[model samples]
Target: MVNLTRIYTRTGDAGSTRLSDMSVARKTDLRVEAYGHVDEANAVLGMAITSGGLREDVVAVLRAVSNELFDVGADLSNPLVAEPKWEPLRIPPESIDRLEAWCDEFSESLPDLVSFILPGGTPGAAYLHLARTVVRRAERAGWAAAEAYGLEVSAGDEPGGVNPLALTYLNRLSDLLFILGRVANEGVGDVLWVPGKDREPVGERARRQREKIEKAQDDLGRSS
Candidate 1:
């Protein structure tokens, strides 16, 4: 078990921080950027969990994601450092498979994708969608860092290049969020697909206007 000490060390006072290998780097290092993104993604997911009414199974999956993200962050913090004392922090291929499985499970419940749906749903679902997008950004940052370090081959070997599992997980996560949004809006009422009045073509505007009017009428009836 790691020791937990709250003693303040002013080591980072010069705008530099230490990595897992005890090497110091500027706070703006690429490794820092990558791991910071992971931390951001995890925090956003935590917010979604708090605000979204996720099913028990979904919550379980997200909990697993949180754990994986921590591992990813650790890997980013210490690249190519073979410290036998520190257990390997590789993201296994099975992790990607697990994300794929979850995506398949969630997608099964959603309607066939006939058209692109807008990204507004329940607040929790919307936040999940946002988190998914951020995760993609994080993956891209990781890939860039791998290329910069010329560790592409070794990194790619690890689940999704820098972290193949994370990439796969992010891709599936976006799909899951889209479906979750649909599920959240189901039977709560029809989702109004608002089109841009000024920018949209005439037919599109007319269709969206009709949808808006219908939704307004439904809302009035509910209030009455």
Candidate 2:
């Protein structure tokens, strides 16, 4: 329902921009930083969607998430107020539930994790990994904003705080992206972690480390 006739607005040339409510704030404002990270996360997801070789269902999920992230940005950009002239686009709790459901569904088929995963697999999955990290960063920024501006609305027309639901959405979204990244590696499998594998220790040190790792893995297998 909104239209932008011009992309270039001289208003921000002073290093300040207007929020969704048309209130001016500095470019370095915590709220602005939070929503800016959300925008970055969305763009990375776009890369994942178009990277090719992704499962159709996963693609559909990412597409939906991309749209939701925009709303998340809107929710962050428009600070919470006691009463607004118009209803703001806020992230809903149901959206977080949907992300949880997606995480569970996608995780169902992935192999049980015996070790940590590295962020590399198929090209599509690599992009998903990248997106996941970006989402995590966005979530952190949201928390920082929440810390700076409390999560509760205050009296009057002044913006009070950020939306807690929007923060939760970002948290859940990062998890979903991780699960989908694993799903994207359906054929290639996950790039698993090996503790100190890169160090390549030799002789007695290497022997001790290998023995301990083997014993731990054996214990894990028996317990599972």
Ten contiguous residues with the weakest lDDT in model 2:
215-224
Query: Tens digit of lDDT per residue, candidate 2, span 2-103?
Result: 798998978888899988988889999998998999899888889888889888998899899999998999999888888887899998888999999988
The C-alpha TM-scores of every prediction are 0.75, 0.89
Q: Whole-model lDDT, candidate 1?
A: 0.65
Off by over 4 Å in 1: 81-85, 152-175, 179-224
Candidate achieving the largest lDDT: 2
Candidate 1 residue-wise lDDT at 97: 77
lDDT of 2: 0.83
Task: Give lDDT: candidate 2, residue 81.
Answer: 87
Residues 1-224, model 1: lDDT tens digits: 55969768888889999876566778987777877888898998898778857677767777888888887787677656333346657666777777777778766755443234555546666777677778877777776776666454343324212434544555565566556555554434324444465235478767676665555536633432
